[model samples]
Target: MSKNKIITVQNVTVTISSEELDDYICITDIAGVKSDQSRSADIIRNWLRNRSTLEYLSVWEQLYNPKFKVFESEHFKKQAGLLTFTPSVSEWIEQTGAVGLYVKRGRFGGTYAHKDIAFEFASAISPTFKLYLIKEFQRLKEEENSKERLEWTAKRFLSKNNYLIQTDAVKNYLIPKSNYKDNLEWLAYAKEADILNVALFGFTAKAWRDANPEMAGKSNVRDFATVNELTVLSNLETHNAQMIREGRDKKERFTILKDIAEYQLDILNEAEKIKIEEKEETEETV
Candidate 1:
């Protein structure tokens, strides 16, 4: 579990955890919608004891969990649907090594099931509730994806603005100092821009276009860059401009900018990893 997000279906607030790439929905909360809060555990256990539920769980575990205990699952399958065969979430995990469901304890504590299983479990609550849950979940994911695209667009805009700063430095400081004629001065700006491109992306604009001819007219390399790459590119543009002002040669500036790009990208990647780990820990405690 990472951070917890919520969706309300028929006034029932259900918690969701985006665990890695999969979404885990709080089945305990779903149970509350079917019965009183105190009977949620019993409701879940009753569902778990159903033979059809056991068959579905066994198939899911076999498909996704290499470490799943098949023999233990078989033992449970034989007992499923019996009056004395109630199983708790923790017991199932311990015996079968299942990853489809997990019991988290704390303020937001509950049994969370992977979206596939949660949707199945929701049917046991009510077909109407299950349909609403699926609809709301899809809406939440689409909203998140849209937000991510918006952030990427904002970063791309920032990178373009910084590129203008870099070009201005070349026009004011580097071009006039060179022997280029009036009409050919544009080459100096192009060369300076390529220096940063080579340092960060290991290719010139023309080289990238030649390599991806299909995307040449529609988008450049920067348009396809990751958020971290765009961030480092933005920084490199500023640094390259300052270097040009200091009268650094193209070769020397490229070398320094490449080193900075590598170092900053490494730091940013590691920071992102740490942030995810910290979020998971915080969610577990909560």
Candidate 2:
């Protein structure tokens, strides 16, 4: 998942900043859902002043955050639930070196917390709300994973068909004209196939195998191609077949096919970025 993955929990639109380490939920959005958007900061401070809240935060930081300032966390705990003990998200982060909470500024400004911390905060607001939040968040992740699988499968099918077409071209053109014995003519077909493979992947089949012996044993280089690479490869395969039928030599075809692969990959990659960015923008408004 991308960093900007958002999931709507009940009436709350929680943005999940999915990073390699952990997913952070927008605490401000969760606060807004429980009370009001304008009062989110005040609500957060109110929660922070509670003794239980500070204890929970301290335990969490101790467990998950190596750099957390346990001494300062103890100091904060000492003053918890006082008449003027309210703390902001920024204070928590600055004082305790807490990574569990974050306060972002600007148009989309808000406090965000790691999923574990956010869910705890939600429980303070309402237990039922936290349960619903968990459900929707799980559903959102499953849906995103499914969408990725579908796209990959679609690209795989197209590239597989393109590979088939290239094989037909090899049989029709290279096999008939080879000077090698009938059984040995298969080598010529393989050589011709590698021309397109090299043009798109930058490695001949044997070179790729030597470089990635374990992976190559189970899957070819094409199996691990990105969507953009696969899209360009499908097109390259079809074009290489046409060039082969025209009796182009490997040297000339490789030059032309390589250029096509580079150009199409660039175009397709840029288009894909634009498509994803537009979708993110639309989701923000909704």
* Most accurate candidate by lDDT: 1
TM-score between candidate 1 and the true structure: 0.59
Q: Could you list the CA RMSD of all candidates, in the order they appear?
A: 20.1, 19.5
Deviation in Å, model 1, residue 7 alpha carbon: 1.2
User: Each model's TM-score, in the order given?
Assistant: 0.59, 0.54
- Per-residue alpha-carbon lDDT of candidate 1 for residues 88-207, written as tens digits (9 for 90 to 100): 989999999999999999977899999999999999999999999999999999999899789868867776565555555442332112222222333345676677766676666776
lDDT for each residue of candidate 2 in 1-286, tens digit (9 for 90 to 100): 3267677777678788875346788888888876789998999999998889889988988876777899988888889878878788888899889888887777556888888888999998889989999999889879988997798688678665655556555423321122222123233445765766766766567756765666667866676566678778778877876775455666677778888988998898799899999999999999
- Please give the CA lDDT of all the candidate structures: 0.81, 0.76
Q: Model 1: runs farther than 4 Å from truth?
A: 163-286
Question: Clash totals for all models, in order?
Answer: 0, 0
Clashing pairs in 1: none
